[model samples]
Target: MSPVSETHLAHRLNLRLNVEPSEIGGIRHTVIQHIGSWECAAIADDVILVVSELLANVHEHAEGVCELEIEHQDEGLVVKVSDTFMTPPTLGHRHGSAETGRGLLLVDALTDHWETTITGTGKVITCTFGTPGRGISP
Candidate 1:
């Protein structure tokens, strides 16, 4: 069978919110709403989850404000989460008694691709998930 054609668009949404602990869910919802009309709902959800984790981390550890920018691509959505915290995120080992270090770990598990870039202001964690047609069948 031929490769399926996928709907695609590239745009960016900026989320500005207080780094207060309670704002993480709002950030996630913002992302979901922004991506709702895309044909890649599954990928959108994955990106939303990753974005949530990163934002939560900022709320728990960072200061002042946190921002998120999502770029929708043909194959997937690219998510970037930035905060004032200069320290890199810790992907704590869950094998032990650690109950609270799995944010980035979850991002790793959910996204098909991800990476972190240290910016002049802070670090931006980028993650991506493939849309339906981009899936490769074995």
Candidate 2:
């Protein structure tokens, strides 16, 4: 998939969040509210889960704060989380007993497409979820 340019997005929301576990619930609520307003219920759950997973990674691995950007595209919603951590995430094979390493796996399963881009400040993990049977407006 080609990178989504800002010009093509119908709607965009950007948020800066502290890397705290307590911040996850509030951010999830915010995302759901936006999804609700967008009338994209068909992919709401998937979008929420993907956002949660990405935020959890930021809280667990990154330092300071992270930026969350959600955009409405012609095909679906694009979610990007930027953090100060320079190392990109990898999908690691973990034992069933492992508790901490499965987030990215869940992210991979839920999103239609996902990629990590290293920036000068840090890295951004972008995820795309296709919305079906619904029309998204600006």
Question: Candidate 1 regions off by >4 Å?
Answer: 1-10, 135-138
List of clashing residue pairs for candidate 1: none
For residues 54-111, what per-residue lDDT tens digits would candidate 2 score against the true structure? 8788877896368889987777898999999999999887899986889889888988
Return model 2's CA RMSD, one decimal.
6.6
**What TM-score would candidate 1 get against the native?**
0.79
lDDT of 2 at 79: 90
Top-scoring candidate (TM-score)? 2
All-Cα superposition RMSD per candidate: 8.6, 6.6
Per-residue CA lDDT of candidate 1, range 1-138, in tens?
Answer: 011121223466766666555656665665677688665676776777777777677767776366667776676677777776778776656766677776777888997777777889888776777777684121
